[model samples]
Target: MRELLITWGDGGGELAGRLVRELRAAVREGRLVAGERLPASRVLAAQLGVSRGVVVEAYEQLAAEGYLVGRQGSGTRVAAGVADGGARPPARVVETEPRYDLKPGTPDLGMFPRAAWAGAVRRALQGAENRDLGYRDPAGLPQLRRELAAYLGRVRAVVAEPERVMAINGVGQGLALLVQVLARRGRPRIAVEDPGSPGTLALLRAHGVRPIGVPVDEEGLRVGELAASGAQAVLVTPAHQYPTGVVLSARRRTELAAWARAGGLVVEDDYDAEFRYDREPLGAVQGLAPERTVYLGSLSKTLAPGLRLGWAVLPGRLAEDFRQAKQYADLGTGAIDQLAFAALLESGGYDRHLRTVRPRYRARRDALAEALRTHLPQARLQGVAAGLHLYADLPADTDEQAVADAAARRGVRVATVGPGRLAPGGPALALGCAGLPEQRLREAAALLGEAVREAGGTVREAGGAVRDVGGLGGAVS
Candidate 1:
């Protein structure tokens, strides 16, 4: 243990964190055998001349991260499988694997704030009380609820109060819970924005709630259509419609809110509103109709999705029922995770992270737009100023499947919007730019352009005057 700590670093304030990292690396590298007993916190601390709290904290963090297991009298041991020592094989890059991944549903993983997140976790563990460690309220940790409510109010103009907020695993779970509650409340059809997230539509159906798809145009979801569909409850991505990228217009917002004010339920998925680049993002529709809106948001967009953290702001009438539903769902999400997220939010660490990441995402978005302009000039790109994915409208007669298949053969994956949603509008592709940098985005554009032509569509040329559209001649380092 002393040797391991020595190899990690000279002990100080970061001793616990460094120890956790060091032990994790040892387990991953096969230096630590699985099921091997670890030194007790006191013994290890004495041996290393550090406080026992350091070792205890290290053990706790490792346990939380699933790297180590601790038992009362059994002591701690390295976890199985992920780090079995000597049995783990080396990693190698697969040549046939796609060179770049620009598919939607993932964020720029490279920009994750490792140090800040670790610090937040450390602080949360140190500050958490004994009661906080137990199976507590299903509404989520009060600390997290308080912080998240404040953060949402200040950042999104959301009408959130701690008592009415419920922390969820992510938007998926949030929607599931909402659907269940609504289904029990006699809402059989859950209206959703057409050209919206198909995954969400599937989620609604899987939860036994029929989905009513309403058409969305340039200004956003058609409120007229929504009202005509006869759905008392609707799930919408109003900030930026999935696959369409249009913000809800002022008229539409007023109309939707008025509908909700008249007792219609609104479930707002404010996806990617934090990453907007054009103008200030519109306030959430939930804010427009708090009494009827159930606002759903998650860190999946602004933060790493792997964190699996999100929250729902429920109306006063449904808040208690939603909390009870969450309690029955999974006995509530992990409290430690909630506390850590709260710590990050209270310290403004989350905001700082967004500030740093937003610009990078914008640059990637710009690169994709530039590539599209130069290579696939016949395709007009819309919704480029917000969200990680942009909607590329191909010629009215272009074959979407051919463009999609051709791009797939070349190593890029363009989103293929299926039937029911693409009606009336020409064939379009939701090109995701978040996962790739400038050069890869440009290359992806060039590949898609070739696919479009092969699929019986014409490509426009800029007379060869611009060598690289969007200054993407070479990949930005």
Candidate 2:
């Protein structure tokens, strides 16, 4: 092992200051990684031929500032959150090995095109005017709006003009804006798919919008039930429905369009529609009647979630109200990010990156499916037509939560659709195949199978509960 090189300070006023700077530089350069115990004060003093008290004082200053975490037995290890000075703790402990993270709704960050992104940022900065730095449009930069309008037209068949497109932080904020607009119309009750995204459902409720649960089936949202609930607005993920990946059937799509045309409004969340592998891409329901549908799409899946960039194509009637809502929300998304994304779209970089990573994700998805088949032949799979994650049905006797707990104990993280249920005992586990490396994906699936077996149930075989074409099991869980 290489030894830490410490230089002695002078007796002058600047000596201690120089030493602190050197020490900080060493840590910043990763000469000291987290958890590596530092030398004792006496040892460091002797090595540097300095007074022991000096070393001790330096260590004390760092500890007080949260740079070093010290314990009687643990010595001084690097502490995370040093910059925040203990305002936040470290993130949840995640297993390092087996690297498979099948958690749902995240894209493979490893596949993020760093070079292209950097290029876009550089180009944007170079062309940016001094006035561009000012807090400008709250509805996003004009260039990005135009680029997105063009892109959405081709991909989602959205009838988006730049004027109708409003860029906001993300889906969460987009939903919030819609809630405010609908609230103005006295439409407080919103219908969500049964077993829909919990975070989204809660966000609506927090904003004083009541969300009623409507059942989703192979044909997608139950339109008749949606009407019966007396909800004036509804959120539907039509392209590849969340958790189940079911495409809204043609008949149902028409029925929904009719429903919207008659009176109600639709919030069509086009989440994860780009990653469909099986059939041809389905045009958004918004395309049929842009006047009745409020279309929401985001880069959280296609690019990365941290970007906080998403767009909503509102109908002409609701356009003015939605734009005003955005103005009061966050003054639009940051201008720099909007320009960067617009460059990404105009340059064709975003689609290129997607083409590159799609095969890699496809491979990981296949690995997960094969692992399920080999390890637990009886488990049924569902919703693999398109999307980052898929679902599997556990036997009725199996405790889905217990299996999730057991998997976590073995350093695996898998989720269940049952917990997302508006009712109890949904009997399914939602497993995401994205973000994890192939090896980890296989291991996680195998661990899940073991977890199911330990929970005292077996997956059914060939004639069992297969639902979608990609071996996604039953959604009735």
TM-score of 2: 0.77
RMSD per model, one decimal: 11.0, 9.4
- TM-score, structure 1 vs. true: 0.76
Over 10-39, each residue of candidate 2 has an lDDT whose tens digit, in order, gives 645554455566666556556666666788
Clashes of 2: 11
Per-candidate Cα lDDT values, in order, are 0.79, 0.77
Q: Mind giving the per-residue lDDT tens digits that candidate 1 earns over 234-255?
A: 8788888887788889999999
- Winner by TM-score: 2
Name model 1 segments beyond 4 Å from true.
1-97, 419-425, 457-477
- Residue 77 Cα positional deviation in candidate 2, in Å, after optimal superposition: 34
Candidate 2, position 354, lDDT: 83
